[model samples]
Target: MIVTRFAPSPTGRLHLGHAYSAILAHDFARRQGGRFLLRIEDIDGTRSRPEHVKTIIADLAWLGLSWDGDVVHQSQRLSAYAGALDRLREMGLLYRCYCTRAEIAAASLSAPHGAEPIYPGTCRVLTRQNAERPHCWRLDMARATAIAGPLTWQDHGRTIVADPLTAGDVVLARKDAPASYHLAVTVDDAWQGVTDVVRGQDLFAATHVHRLLQALLGLPTPAYHHHRLLTGPDGVRLAKRHGAPALAALREGGSNGLALATELRVGRVPIGATDT
Candidate 1:
């Protein structure tokens, strides 16, 4: 059976963009007689809050959406993530990165503003061992790509070539967190038997790295649907950081959630809101 998931970090409440993505994934699963799962991406221990997690569950419930099975929390699966990292390390695809954020920024001064600076492989060749120093594990993209060869993944219905190098060598495990977003999500999706990945276009670029991870880990690749994102009048995408209103606020304000969901399904966004 087809399976999809709506995974949200518990750092903030569910905004309109989040709701739209959830609704699309849920509707697609239901229409195909499949299962829709909910996952709490609380890997970032410093930022994740229990109160926010509670509100996230409440918000989704208030939106008139139901998820199949119990909710999956990323925090509870540290061992699984560790195992993946160990496997990659054994394959000589992982290396320790000791560069600080400021140092990386200084090295990436030539990169465009707001663009993610590709790591210059500063730590890729370090042979000295510093157990006392803090470090994160990064994937050697060049070496990994050499082993996996060319890769591709399904986006909507098109087969797009995987360009993991575009993001440079991504961190698979961080010193502050047991697993990076890229590592945890890829492992979780495969473990959950997720067949389809329905999310926003903003994440379309990250899929490239995910495809390479799948190939290296011998995990199955799922079909992907990069749906349009919801934005406000200013054309900026709706996000918690951007001050997008929470779904719970709309629910408590006497708004009809079922009606709102209906309008969303038809691509009708709220006043001052647009989909892009």
Candidate 2:
């Protein structure tokens, strides 16, 4: 059976862009008679809020999207992420790096595009004691890619590809956090049986890291569809940072589900067309 999920970070309210993605996933699963799941990506504890989580669920329901199964929250699955990290460490596929943000920024001055401030393998040679210094855990790209070999996965119904070397050394666990986006996302997708992923094009570049993790962890790789992100009138991506209008705000302004569906191009009728 085809299984899909709409995982969203609860750092802010759901906007029209979120609705577009969620509806797409729901419709895809519904059309295929499959399952649609919801995952709350709240691993970034510092920025995630309970109110935002509540609002996200409510907003999706208001937009007429229903998901199957209990929602999976990433914060509650730290042990699973830690176990995956441990597996990588045991295989000698992870290293510890103590490089601070300032150090990386200084080194990035002359780095090439998509390769800014690469890890430089700073701690790849560290002894056990040296590795114990205040540092984050990074995946050894050379070792991981060697094991995974040439990596490729499906994206937007196309074959998307990645080379671990060009992707560079990825941080798996920060000093202050147990799991990064790469590790957490891979684990959650497998655990939830998500066979397909429908997300924004902005994340397309990060697929390299995700493919590496999936291969290293021996998890099934899912098909991906990276749709065009909804942009504002200014041509910039809609986001909480720029104060884009949220779905909740629009609903409060008396906009109904039909209006939202029309704006997203999912409604039966056109936006400004009148009924006969």
lDDT of every model, 2 decimals: 0.90, 0.81
Determine which window of 10 residues in candidate 1 has minimal summed lDDT: 267-276
Clashing pairs in 1: none
Q: What TM-score does candidate 1 get on C-alpha atoms? A: 0.96
Candidate 2 — worst ten consecutive residues by lDDT sum? Answer: 267-276
Question: lDDT tens string, model 2, 163-211?
Answer: 6676678899988778998899999999998899888887877888898
Q: Give the TM-score of candidate 2.
A: 0.89
In candidate 2, stretches whose alpha carbon ends up further than 4 angstroms from where it belongs are 110-117, 128-132, 266-276
lDDT score, candidate 2: 0.81
Residue 145 of model 1 has an lDDT of: 94
